[model samples]
Target chain A: MAQNPNRPISPHLQIYRWGPHMAVSIFHRATGFVMATAGMLTLLWWLASIAGGPESYATFQSYVVSGGEEATGMQVAINWFFRLLALGVTYSFFQHMFSGIRHLLMDLGAGYELKTVRTWSIAVYIAALTATALVAMLVAARFMGA
Target chain B: MGNGTKLGRVRGLGSAKHGGKHWLDQRLTAVGNLLLTTWLVLSLLWLPNFDYETVAAWLAQPSVAVPMILMLANIFWHVRLGLQVLIEDYVHDEGNKFATLTLLNFYVIGGAAFGIFMVAKHAFTGAPA
Candidate 1:
């Protein structure tokens, strides 16, 4: 079939002006991928560690959390790295959750208007951070109080 | 165009008959993940501590174990569907798409099975009710 070479084609990622909705949409998938890989692997490790008994779980805790009292320099660095990774996963979890909620709302035929969607898209970012903060506070209080 | 009815001419051209099913399953698992993940964060939060004993005892209960297993399965399924769509969109070559997709399924299934098995073991042998 013959086609016009000069025809204006669809604008792509670089061609369009970036917007909150576009950013959020991409983040949703990126965050989802992160969770499905790193997050889920960590979870499986946690579960398998528990099943392996206290000693095994203690190994996990030492590596992932405490770095052990007699920590080698390498152990300290690795443990901190895992801690940062965990934090990243936590943030991604919340981010994915709120973005997912936004999607669910749209699925129900709500918030389709340009203004409403833009407002809610931005709200997803804030809500995810707020929820993550709440969890951090609650966990901190629990650990500190005891 | 081929001496057939309109329906015949358009048969198997769009949707491929399976696309709708995949779309619906993705949304369904999304809802499942929303509930399961919420329950998990809240449950973990409500627990007294995050130590090995505390966490292990928590998962040992049938109530917790059942839901956790379901959550892991649901999440794996959801991820498989999501990644399949992602691969479909980005992996243009037929051979590459098939290879990646096969690996994706293998990874998801292996992870899900291990997770569920670990949870079940904890539930059965870890702590007394």
Candidate 2:
């Protein structure tokens, strides 16, 4: 187990053809990181606004949610950026959740077979996509006052 | 002086007995996050609105506030553990890796504390009128 500098490095992205399970595994880590950053920032801003009371909350809403009726062009651009970020975060949340479930099941000594692993991997993706779409639609409906 | 027994060398220099703890903690937080995040999504979806007032009102409820605090703590802990592994793997320079890990711990701890404090404030003081 001592260091062996002459030993060849293990096969990885360069040597292997990626498959569903590999993709899902990569995405699980990637999305987890993304959601963590986004969640931290949003939560901090939200908490600050709430602690500061209604006036501060209103100010935060104008910036983060509504963008106000008399929005400047720059403000509009920023609002669009936040909107896209919000959607991305929503997708990440679901993707990470499903992938986490897959990992939990694997940890429980299940889904070791190739077919079962692949099936679960694909299932995670599908669940994330479907849930993200539904949540996006609900958000849109809420915004449109439907 | 290279005279140590093989077992001594292996135990002293080889396996860092702490890895299993890190792995175990990561999985424990992962399970916590799975449940809490699901609850969060469902709660948000059930909300009447996403405006500041509506969200503030929701957080003011003791039921919501308690879980929200727990979720925030679990999330930050998990984030730190995951990011630590990522940094250790990719960051080659020992100095940089140490710096990055230290900064990461401070960031996650500080952010979690701020979040929980806010939740507690709202929970205790009630929603703004």
Q: On residues B4-121, what C-alpha lDDT tens digit does candidate 2 reach at each position?
A: 6545556646677799999999999998988887898789888987766788888898889999999999999999999998898777577888899999999899999999998898
Cα error, candidate 1, residue A65 (Å): 1.1
Off by more than 4 A, model 2: A1-15, B1-14
lDDT of 1 by residue, A23-118 (tens): 899899889999999999999999999999889998888888776679999889988898778778888999998998899889889998899989
Shift in Å, residue B100, candidate 1: 0.6
Candidate 2's displacement at residue B122, Å, is 2.1
The best candidate by TM-score is 1
Q: Runs in model 1 with CA error above 4 Å?
A: A1-12, A144-146, B1-12
Q: What DockQ results do all the predictions give, each relative to the true complex? A: 0.52, 0.50
RMSD for each of the candidates: 4.1, 3.4
